[model samples]
Target: MRQYKKVLLGVASIVLIIVLAACGNIDDSSSSTSSSGKKTTSVQTTGQVSKSEYAGVIKNGHYLTSKARGLTANRNSNSLNITSFENGLLGVSKSYYSTSNYIFQEGQYLTTAKLTNWLGRKSKSNPTGLNPKDNGKKNSSRNPIYVESIEEQDFMQKNGNSLVLKGITIGIAMNTIDYYQKIKYGATYQQTITSKERVAYGKKVAKLIVERMRKIKKIGKNVPITIAMYKQAANDSLVGGSFYAKTQTTSSNISNWEKMNVENKVFPEISSTSDYASNDNKSFENFQSQIENYFPTISDVTAQAKYVNKKITGEQVTITTQFYSETEIISFTNFIAQVAPKFLPSGVPVNITVNSANGIQAFLSRSSTQRNFKSHVFSSY
Candidate 1:
């Protein structure tokens, strides 16, 4: 009887160990759930939250937009203490510019409704056939789409190692123009003008504003000016659309006449004649060719690269690649950093971000003083 009890106990101990091991395996496979019932994966080492968590924080467009505007308006300091999610997602703080006082004065002449109407007049198929009007309209008490504000901010370059403080951003708010209707219908204004015509018009508007701004004696004569137009659509609070133009004063003539000149004589060097300011389209084409010749694996995939003077970061190279697995993100990002600069204008510092179908997979940035790129991996899948 004693021998039989000992054998039975041993068998029970073995079965208990097997059951515990199976439970451990199940726990390993399971993910933690948030209060909203969303599964979350924690990176214990980096303490980085999942992309969904980051998106949840950023999706509050009103709050984010207000925060960005407030940060730009406050002239008391240079640095801002952003939350962990923002830091992790954006990777850097103080990347945007605060517009100078002179630009704000010029903004008074341009209202959102007026600009829209101006574009409407320029449109080839203006159903109403509105006449082209000069930008002398009184500042409307309420504007549907207007230049709400301006700011001067910094831009990161060279994988985030260099910083450029020559960015001027014009904030635009679209309050009307079927603001709510477009959301439900999924259609915005149909383009009546050719892409070339639209670009020409935008450039003309920018040149006029730049001319007025140069009249301000406080601004330097040789300042390399980077003008960015950030537009917030009525339906969306975030800056969904942006346009850019770059120019510099090569002439010593700082007279009122020189400042008033709207012709090409005012700006000796115009970086781009397009709407977005930078020479991104040509650079993108060149980058595509380089990729095809060098990296065959991703050569056939459709890729797009643009130099964006972001609100938070002065200037950045945002690249969207064809659907790529998370594991390949690092390799691809390194490859881009190596080849992209070759096609872009030299000496302009800019950071790089790699995006896939899933979302932003990696961010490579450097401060102006740093030489090496500090990379942040967000999502692999």
Candidate 2:
């Protein structure tokens, strides 16, 4: 009986050892995840659904008050309101507030909330009147002129009187000359001018010119808009003859001229609208969509019908893309041509041919080269 007891004790020790080993292994490998001989994670995505598939509510509203004074933003509901401004201009002078809540799915925000708040008040017929600071005064500004080169002869012709030139505004043209004239001739005290008075006016004009030039710099870079002023004796000598550039130097001066011209002369004018429209409207959304629709989705020729307007035969869509280099254009075209087919529905056949002048043609009004290029490409389509 004693020998049997000893054997039973030894068996109990072995069982305890096995149980301890199993518990240790559980801590390292079996904590709520299957061990597939690969690294495991506690992150909570099943990976069956796409990250963008998660959805949330997005609501917004706009209210315009009958007073036509101000607009308010409702951030909680993701909405905006415009009130009492039907009679006034379209703008909200007051600051707006908003709030948002979002959820992360696969490290992406899949849900959101927002709130906006707004306040309104009665507005004046002339908003400028309500804002006592504005006082309905016109913005004071100086005109700018660009000259390739300034020489002594050009200076002599523009002496003291103002004149307008081609390809420039009257205000900017005159302002440039005014700068040099004051610097050269010292003014007398009184006669509606004195040392301090002249200095004040000079500083005021200079500041305006500098501000306008900053704008020009933003638009034209260092494109070099030169200002030149000349001084020549008056024909009668007693009239204090002065002829300035064709451009005026101040906004007030320009306004006066415009008002006068309407009643007096048919002035010659050159507008910069074309250049501004071309450069500034490059990324305009409306224009971008006009070209995006033409992209074909299938590789087969029959697939082209899916992208082509069925009602219109031989319809060709022209895309004007601004690219710094021709290589970028080629790469973009090839990328679209290659990838578009995979996304198309099964039956449609499509092809994309990039015309060489796609970038330049967009800027030109009616260049013969662009017309000919279009003719060559569409002749086959």
Maximum-lDDT candidate: 1
RMSD per candidate (Å) reads 22.1, 32.1
When summed lDDT is taken over every stretch of 10 residues in candidate 2, the lowest stretch is 109-118
How does candidate 2 score on lDDT? 0.21
TM-score of each: 0.31, 0.15
Give candidate 2 regions above 4 Å deviation: 1-256, 259-287, 293-381
Every candidate's lDDT: 0.33, 0.21
Task: State the lDDT of candidate 2 residue by residue for 1-381, as single tens digits.
Answer: 000011111121111112221322122221233567553422221111333221111111111111111111111111111111110011100000001111111101100110000011113422211011222222222221111011100000111221111111111111112111122244311112233433333334334333443354222323222222212221222111112221223222212111111000000112334432232123222323333544442111111111111221111123433332444544445444443333322232222344433223121111212221211122211
Query: Which model scores highest in TM-score?
Result: 1
The TM-score of predicted model 2 comes to 0.15
Error of 2 at 155 (Å): 9.1
Model 1 C-alpha RMSD vs. true structure (Å) is 22.1
